[model samples]
Target chain A: MSEARLNTPISPFPSREQKQEERAARRAAVLRAAVRMFNARGFHATSLEDVATSLGISKPTIYHYLGNKDQVLLECVTIGLQQLLEAGAAARAGPGTGADRLQSFLRRYAEINMDDFGRCVIRTGEEALTPESVRRFRDLKREIDTAMRELIEEGVADGSIAPVDPRLLAFALAGALNWPARWHDPAGPQSPGELADLLVATLATGFLPR
Target chain B: MSEARLNTPISPFPSREQKQEERAARRAAVLRAAVRMFNARGFHATSLEDVATSLGISKPTIYHYLGNKDQVLLECVTIGLQQLLEAGAAARAGPGTGADRLQSFLRRYAEINMDDFGRCVIRTGEEALTPESVRRFRDLKREIDTAMRELIEEGVADGSIAPVDPRLLAFALAGALNWPARWHDPAGPQSPGELADLLVATLATGFLPR
Candidate 1:
């Protein structure tokens, strides 16, 4: 009404950037809640309603943010796989011999498997996802496997690693690290970092004497 | 009333031992069918009807033989664990150093994991079972873990295996071997024995150069 009020230029609505940020935050929160429940309970046992109830939101709100339970699980596992892929890439780009880079990637891989999204990736089976999601999940997992094999091949070429079958060696190392997802107790004495180091060390030297 | 009839040895009905044997055979067949389905489709997604239909029987027949789905799963995993336990005992009793015994046990362990009931054990999550079933499952699994730890301890004491934490080492080895249940294909190029050998060889020496 007044010239001063018109010149103030303050709006009651949130700006576009603020609205986008809020939406992203809400989506992440819903995903976090869903993944934790899925991890604690089996995927079939956990309901989207339970996730929504934990977050003080409605079931429709979850659907709006994440589409459905299957989509939520797919997203969680994808994020975990992406983190592993990024870690492999980073390790490849970074340091010493092939052995050193492989170890670095392995340590990060183990640590990620112990976290929320990472645990979901390990705990989830192919039968839990839809056909399309399972295909995507397998594709992403294969890429990670290929990256590990490449690292091992490089190490072998440089004589930093032993002349072993890279494929089998990768499976052994990944299995040793991934098992922590099933057995590692977050409340136990060893932290994720500590457990990862011990596992990687065991895989490096093995049971046989040097 | 005839003398020949009175002296006849043949009977129309089966003997008690024969009946018992038949019953046992039928029960085993049902269990095999159920475990295969559970492993392929997952515990939650698999139905008793599907298992029965595959075997050309009805659902009640499955219930009659295995009690319920939970009981069937528990039986499957329990059989797998018992096989592992028996292998451990056999290895302990066999001739050789602790390391030799441990390797013998580990090979059998990997082979059993690729079998029907053993694959079921690896695929079924604790959450898939009822509370009581889960408790029993955990107890059986704990016994296996103890057996593995004892093998590692004996090997360490005899200087056959390197000095490492028996608990962590056992976890690493068991994890590496147990993973074949998820990835090993029965129709693949390698036989279970060949694959087991490869996996154990990888673990015995590890990735690092000797």
Candidate 2:
């Protein structure tokens, strides 16, 4: 363990400032591994050793980067939520009507289903987290929900979309996007783009035969 | 463990007849406890002991009742899916216009949300099941999806609802109903009745000012 640390200081306990930078990089790497494991076996089924095994490191190495397993889960979920918000905002400038912009968001949303961030430990179970972690996740979700609601409202005001309840539509759209992670397979016939277009079409326009 | 078995007898399991019934009962009990835990902690985080302990039984007892942990998960999800299909059907009578039937289904769908069966473990993480289990769930989901699509088409044909893509509408409306599992709090401000009304209204008429 000591020799491993000496060759590659992956923790914050180095003798100098260089240690901190090394620690951050190590943490990011561990976080990446954590995302994959947690999504596969789930947060509870995954252990510190499982993570270390996947990373070709020792259990102590995990403490150096993540401190504890829970922290890794928190980081993965927090970072994912942050990315989703950014992606949603990025879609606001895309072409088409409010429905079109919303569609763009749906397309981005579909992409999340392919990998770990979309198949996250947090999104899969709220009951697994301590109240504190849940609160943190909820806070992040609330911000994104608010952003989405505003986008829906914009559609309504611009007369590009029907006047649906903004908050409801936002949540409704979110449910459709998020649901795919529970079942959609990347190797499956339906491409993400195809699913996104169909999803957006249903939400923006009603099922009423046009 | 042997002592507990004494009350039930192991002969021929002579009661092999009753044994089946008892097994069914034990299985249901395990499933109920599982739903509560899965709802609270998630399928992966919950352990076999957790299910047994909650039932005041031994771990082996659970194995006898359920083949294994995965089977329990499968059973619970299967139950949840069945309830939805049954309830959705009851909500809207068949042989009616697709729009009319779908609206009817939504009303019943909302009512089911008020029941524990509706908000069980399966709804939150059906994907947490094994591949075989997932295939079964998805196949069942497909059947329901097809029914909804047919209803959407009927609505389009009758002109009672807007003429739009029924395929897309099927998912969006279904998404709305399924989302309650993640966000709905039974003791919160809205009762199931209120929530159902809100859901039906949002899906049927939409957030549009009209």
Candidate 3:
């Protein structure tokens, strides 16, 4: 034990918590770079080397940090969905009419889709993913869809929203919110927040039962 | 003179009009096959051979009819845009109110995007095209956007729509309508027409000045 202690340097390894935090931070940084490249050159066309070059890291480093291209994409999508789901939860918890909560949730949803990670999530299609990954992606997307529908139903029940088909309404709202990721210009005059506000307001103002 | 007459066949070949018709039909068939394949397995992953095999035609036949993959994609996008432009024209001509025209136009637009050709057009992005093709595609899409904005402005001016920013409203409407191409399932419960109607009603019912 004394020989082992003598051979080992003090603070040779980080604490477990510290290592976990560092790993997470590195993972996030790699994901950010990956998402950017994926958005610019579609998910299929983008290789790990492409991502590695952009971040000034080696291809194996990306694989080391994130398992593979699929895992990288899945991670980005999970982060994006988690953010939207959290926003939905917050909106539900906030004090407001159902309509107000729905609107706020939608606005955040739209803004997120145009953000760094979210844009990648929206742009990456099932064709790029493995069968299992596709299933997971679809399930998560469906969860979001169900949440939107339920929010709309709540609004209708409470007399804040019009009596519309919740499923169809959810589709329309989600479609509009998800679309900005495809065409939104980050350098354009409209910031993500401004564009999100404009879209959500249009839906809210036009959708209310008069 | 007798020898010349004997040498010439009784019915030498098809007339110019007949030949043109045949060529056009074959071209249409090739395009149809290409669009279907592109929609099924995105544009980049799809090859001329895949389209040809699906149609039981040869790759040379696809090239003979459509020139190349880039040409195939450009043609599909052109057809999609033309259909939308035609719908806009029809809406403009068949009028109860400006809002009525806009709603009708939007419904048709959504349905077109869900159709085989239009779905391919939506799924094909700029990354897959040459710079010139991308420019042309963007120009046509911009034309559609402008038409939508004008329709909304007319509705607002005529007191059929609420006083909203027409450009923003147009984007919201177009985003909602264009998105169905990405996720719409033909095997699903909702028919394209039914889905379009529900979406249009949601927007129109909510947007009218109260």
Best by TM-score: 1
As a whole number from 0 to 100, the lDDT of residue B111 in candidate 2 is 60
Using TM-score as the measure, what is the rank order of every candidate, best first? 1, 3, 2
Which CAPRI quality tier does the interface of model 3 achieve?
A: acceptable
Interface RMSD (one decimal) of model 3: 3.6
In candidate 1 the C-alpha lDDT for residue A41 amounts to: 96
Task: Give the 10-residue window scoring lowest on summed lDDT in candidate 2 chain B.
Answer: B118-127
Query: lDDT, candidate 3, residue B80?
Result: 93
Cα lDDT tens digits, model 3, A1-210, are: 598887876676799999999999988889998888888987877898988887788999989989899899998888898888888888888777888889889989999999987887788777778899889888888888888888888888888888888877887888888889987899999999999988887887672224
TM-score of chain A of each: 0.95, 0.81, 0.89
DockQ of each: 0.80, 0.27, 0.45
Better of 1 and 3 by TM-score: 1
Each model's number of backbone clashes? 0, 16, 1
Q: Where is model 2 more than 4 Å wrong at Cα? A: A1-29, A88-107, A113-115, A154-161, B1-34, B41-75, B88-93, B121-139, B153-169, B204-210
Model 3 gets an lDDT of: 0.85
Q: How much is B176 displaced in model 1, in angstroms?
A: 0.8
lDDT of 1 by residue, A1-210 (tens): 999877877876899999999999999999899889999998999999999999999999999988998999999999999999999999999779999999999999999999998999999999999999999999999999999999999999999999988988998888888888899999999999998998898899879888
Q: Each candidate's TM vs. the true structure?
A: 0.96, 0.72, 0.90
DockQ of 3: 0.45
Residue A6 error for model 1, in Å? 8.4
